[model samples]
Target: MNRKAFTLIELIFVILLIGVLSAVAVPKFIGMRDNAKITSELSTAASVQTALEACHGEWVINDAPFVCGNGIRSDSADFNATTGYPVTLGSGDDTPLDKILKNGATVHWKKSGENYYGPASDPQNGTSRCIEGKPCIGKCWRYDSAEGTLKLQTSGC
Candidate 1:
């Protein structure tokens, strides 16, 4: 009586165990994927911020006020026209978040405040609350029209 291989019952049990483990791992993997997407989008936002600072530098150097708040010129050297920002770093349009979602990149962008830029869905967990629902300055960001700077809210989520 040599037990040469796993019995059918043992095979079934192992299969079931693997199935259960996979089921548990899959959701976590999906969540991580979504979080990674969100993090990349946030990085795009930071890029936009850097471009904006450069635009301000141009203004300081008497180059004129290039557009801010969205993408930069596809070629920064071509920022002379009144069309908008240059066109080197990024497109002169909505923020990168907007570009990703609107261009059907399998992600979406919404904001806690009117001016804030992030995902409409919960960025961190994707199941928690999305927007804080307070006004821009109160909850997400503040546009100091006088200083022309975007001030993150005290919460600064």
Candidate 2:
């Protein structure tokens, strides 16, 4: 007639403790995940910037060739003459920025009155600016061809 089962009160207490712990930990874990994403995006942006500079240097060394690899010398049909960068993310065969930032993150472009975004089935054009230095998530990596600048937004992330 000996029973080794735990009491109902003990089981309830254990369940309550688990619930409390989970409630405290879930949000922290989510925040951590978001922070990680932001950090990764920043790193990608830095790498792309470095690559862009290198490409520009090469372009300079070659006496500013009109066409090299996927880069155009002047403001060609697809690239910008001022910065020698692509006008849009995927407009040309394979832009220098594209080769550097391939598959890293979606690249958004900003032109005079036209805008183009990538990785979206129906990318909106000229609707909004992507590199406004705002804190955002999922929309990481913005390339301003006009100024030849690449930025990573992570405030909302």
Give the C-alpha miss distance for residue 81 in model 2, angstroms: 7.8
Name model 2 segments beyond 4 Å from true.
1-3, 60-69, 73-108, 113-134, 137-147, 151-157
Q: Considering every candidate listed, which one attains the maximal TM-score?
A: 2
| Candidate 2 residue-wise lDDT, 1-157, digit = tens | 7979989999999999999999999999877654554455456556667766665665556554454334333435555655565554443333324434555334543333323332211133321223345224335444566666765444321
Tell me the whole-model lDDT of each prediction, alpha carbons only. Answer: 0.43, 0.50
- Over 1-157, each residue of candidate 1 has an lDDT whose tens digit, in order, gives 9778998999999999999999999999877765664455445445545654565565555544344434433235534343333333223333324321234233332333223333323344333323344222123433221243444343544
**Per-prediction TM-score to the true structure, in the order listed:** 0.43, 0.52
> Candidate 1 overall Cα lDDT vs. reference?
0.43
Model 2: which residue pairs collide? 66-73, 135-155, 135-156
What is the Å distance of residue 114 in model 2 from its true position?
Answer: 11
Count of steric clashes across candidates, in order: 11, 3
